[model samples]
Target: MSELMKIQENLRETARKLLANGEASLVIGYALGSEVSRVVPAFISREDEVDRLVWNPLCINNLAKYLLDYRHEPGKVAVVVKGCDSRAIIRLLQDNQITREKVIILGIPCPGLINPDLVAARLDPGAQITVAAVSKQDFSLQTGEGTFTFTRDEALLKKCRDCEQHTPVIADFMLGEEIPPNDPGDPFVAVKTLEELPVEERSAYWDKQFSRCLRCYACRNVCPACTCRECVFDQAEPCWVAKANNLPENTAFHLIRAFHVAGRCVDCGECERVCPVNIPLSLLNRKILKDMKDLFNVPTPGTSLEELPPLGAFTKSDPDEFM
Candidate 1:
């Protein structure tokens, strides 16, 4: 068995024990989606159903967001997380959205996820994946029709390119042997490249991206940092943001949402992935993240529970630039 298959089997067994022993009332993992190239979040409450659990390069959903759904429930919830998704777990814990005692984290040292769109373009329609293997430099997929391979650089998710956290920083249970960490390359390369553009050019670039937005709010909805019970966009009385899909309203939504999660956004890149129009929301979030790192010397939010957000905490030695 490949490492992924081994992990998948281990995950199922772990989840089964958790549910059977009453340790967890719910186990959230990924299962094969109806489509050939898709994997959907699976919610398993019964031990018998644990066989449905799966792990693959396509298990891309940030399962931590679903923990919010069960936060107030009576029993504990177990969740599977990759390095990026594990950050969301920390975000929830720090925000007090979910208590640590109430959730069990099953962390996986992710190799990386493939770009579904890129895979879809290469595969025949409805081609079923039989197996997948990951190596240091590429991933091979054995489909019903044939085996296809792509270099990590060619097929890995954009967020994975500069991934600093391949292994989860926190986990109640680790599902597999720890994978070696990748070199912490320039995490802000995209943001810095965009910053190099002229002021008007930058504005035009964002305007174009925002203009294509369908206002489906998939980005906001999928965002683990966006845990507001009543989001400002949903308000009707004062109407902080209009429901219209025009550029001004869209711009307002994006900017306000970004600032709201400025210190809290874990950079899971879910917002960018779920976006139908393919807005580079990660770039926007990372730009703010770079600023926070430069100004406050704060480590990334969600990396640790003890570290207070730069905006959430007051420090005596803080720079007095504004003062």
Candidate 2:
């Protein structure tokens, strides 16, 4: 069996024990979706349902957001998390969205995941994937029709290109062997490229990207940092943003959201992943993240629970730009 299969089996067994032994009342993982190229979040509450949990390259959804759904429930909830998703877990804990003791984290050292759109384009319609394997350099997929392979460079998700964290920083129970961290060489290459552009050119670039937005709010809804009880965009009385799907409204929404999550975004890349119009939401968030790191010398939020967010903390040494 490939290493992933072994991990999948271990995950199932762990979930089974958690539910059967009353350690957790719910287990959240991934299951086969209606389409072979898709994987949906699975919620297992019974020992018999643990078999529904599966792990594969296609399991890309950030499962941490679902913890908000169960925050008020009485029993502990178990969640499977990749390194990036684990950051979301920390985001919630830091924000007090969920208590740390209320959840069990099953961390998986991700090898990386394939971009679903790219994989879907290559797959035969309705093709069923039977096996998947990953190496340091490439991914191999065994489908019902035949086997296919792609170099990690060609098929890996953009977020994985400079992945600095392969092992979860925090986990109550780690499900797989520790994977070596990617070098993440010059992690800000894309951001730097944009930064080098002329002011007019950079403004034009974002204007074009934001113009294509449909105002669907999928980016906001999927974002783990967006936990406001009443989002500004959704307010009807003040109407912070008009509902019209025009460039001005769309740009306002995106800019506001990017600022709102600034210093708090874990850079999980889920907002970009779920966008139907394919907006590069990660770029916007990363731009702010880069600025934060450069200006405040603060480490990325969610990397550690003890590190306070720059916006959330006040220190005597904080830069005094006003003076």
Number of the top-ranking candidate, with lDDT as the measure:
2
TM-scores vs. true structure, each candidate: 0.96, 0.96
Q: How far is candidate 1 from the true structure (C-alpha RMSD, Å)?
A: 1.5
Model 1, 194-282: lDDT tens digits are 99999999999999999988889899999988999999999998999989899999999999999999999999988988898789999
Off by over 4 Å in 1: 124-127, 143-146
Best by TM-score: 2
Give a tens-digit lDDT track for model 2, residues 225-255.
9999989999988998999998899999999
Under the 3 Å rule for N, CA and C atoms, how many clashes does model 2 have?
Answer: 0
